[model samples]
Target: MRAVSLVPSLTEAIARSAPGAVAGATDWCTHPPDLDVVRVGGTKNPDTGRILSLAPDLVIANEEENRAPDLEALREAGAEVLVTEVRDVPQAFRELDRVLDACGVPSHPRWLDEAEDVWSSLPPPATRRTAVVPVWRRPWMVLGRDTFAGDVLARLGVGHVYATHPDRYPRIPLEELRAAAPDVVVLPDEPYRFTADDGPEAFRGLPCALVSGRHLTWYGPSLAEAPRVLGRALRAARP
Candidate 1:
């Protein structure tokens, strides 16, 4: 079964589980490091013409990472598109299984099972700190309401202020976020590349935990190491 994955996480899972199954992948699908699929383009702006030329039987995408117009265009050209929505850990697990099955894999990849085991085995934290997790800056966008990253942090006993907000990823003014006065500002490496020197300097006094975007955001093999890796980062920045 030939597949084109627009989501990086799915691309990794598919490539890892059944090698050579992916005919094309977005430029951002960088997992497996040695993935040799045809580079279609970015997740948000994939080259639909390039994807179509690959003649994939199945095209996998995420509701959040991929745009609707591109999916529609693929559909209009008679390509079968499987769109997955993963708002939380449980949903992610289910979606991953569904995606693999659609790709003709007989069962869940070993890494997928390992990912679930690790999350279920996570110990409770000593304190559940309320944080403001920012995904982007320069007109800052934050994880607000029903985000997978928020749920991942929630599993780690980290509470975020925007979990109750109406919008999923609301763009709040810098002043408003400062007014929120969260215990720490959690920054992920992707979506913005929040490094120790770059992101922390912005919030003069507040503590910032520079977390891995792949572990925090992507829902695939990285799920296995997220608890340990993210826990360490959060612990190092503990107030």
Candidate 2:
């Protein structure tokens, strides 16, 4: 079964599980580094014509990562599109099973089991830390209420300052974020690519944890490593 994936995590999941089943993927689908698939474009603005040209039996997409118009266009063009909505770890696991099964994967992938094991084995955080997680800079968008990343952090004892906000990804001024005075400033390296030299300066006196965005945000094989990778980073953060 030939598949084209618009979501990066789904692309990696499908590619790793079913091998040659994935015939195309978005340009941002970077995992499985040696993936040899046709580049369909980016998540928000995928090339509909290019995707249709691939002649895939299934197209995998995410509710958050993909645009509705693009998915509709694909369906209009006679492609079977499977859209996934993963708002938390358990949802991610369920969606993984759904997508892989739809793609005709013979058995459960080892990584999926490992991811579940990793999260389930973790003990509750001894001390909860209030954190301001910045997903982008410039205009400063943060992880707000009902975000998958916020839920992931909450499971690890890190709570977002804006978790009660209405927007999923709210853009607020940097000064406003600092005024919240979080226990730690968590910075992920995607969407904004915040590095030690870049993001820390914005939260001078606050403890800053530079984290892997893939581990924190992407739901795939990275889930198995997220607990360890994010835990170490969060532990090392000091004011």
Candidate 3:
């Protein structure tokens, strides 16, 4: 089946679940880099004409990925669109099932079961201090309470002092970094890449670790591998 994936998170799942079946994907679909697949552009402004020309049997889009115009165009072209939206872990599983169903692949309930089991089995993170940079510079955003990243940190035995905040991403006064007094500041490398060379001068006097943002945020079958990688990094960087 010729399918086009426009979401980055689902791109990974589609690549793992369907392998070489993805005929067209977005530029951000680097989880399984499409060295040969057609590019429909990107999540926000996917080339509707290019995707339409491919004449795909199925098109996988996400509420968060495709803009209304492109989505409308796909529908106008009479493409069978399977839209997926994920917020929490359970919703992620439900969306995965839908994608699998779209691809005509057998639903792998065991994988979801295993992921939930692994997630539940994780010892809640300790009260050790930690700070996650959700966005870089400009407004200076941070992960607040109830976000997927916050949940991951909570499970890793790390404390998120900002867990009381309402928004998933909250704009913070840059000076608050000093006030938080976190033992370790984690600068993630995606959505806004924060690197070691970049230095934690802004967080001067605070311990810091640049982390893989994908592992901290993206949850899916990849979590099976990510938890271990993130856990090790967190442990090694422990103060």
TM per model?
0.97, 0.98, 0.84
Q: Say which prediction, candidate 1 or candidate 3, comes out ahead on lDDT.
A: 1
Clashing pairs in 2: none
- What's the ranking of the predictions by TM-score, best on top? 2, 1, 3
* Better model by lDDT: candidate 2 vs candidate 3: 2
List model 1 lDDT by residue over 21-122, tens digit each. Answer: 999998888898999879999999999999999999999999999999999999999999999999999999999989989888997778988999998887
Tens-place lDDT per residue, model 2, 1-239, is 99999988888888888889999999999999999889998999999999899898999999888989989989998999999998988899999999999999988899989999999988989999899999998789999988889989999999999999999999989999999999999999997899989999989899999999999999988999999999999999966
Report the alpha-carbon TM-score of model 3 versus the true structure: 0.84
Is candidate 1 or 2 superior in lDDT? 2
Query: Model 3, 132-233: lDDT tens per residue?
Result: 554576768887766667767666767666777887678888788668888677778877878766636677777776788777776556666567877777
As a TM-score, model 2 comes out at 0.98
Cα lDDT, model 2, residue 64: 88
Off by over 4 Å in 3: 33-35, 109-114, 126-130
| Residue 99 miss distance in model 1 (angstroms) | 0.6
The runs of at least 3 residues in candidate 2 whose Cα sits more than 4 Å from the true structure, single-residue gaps closed, are none
The lDDT-based order of candidates, best leading, equals 2, 1, 3
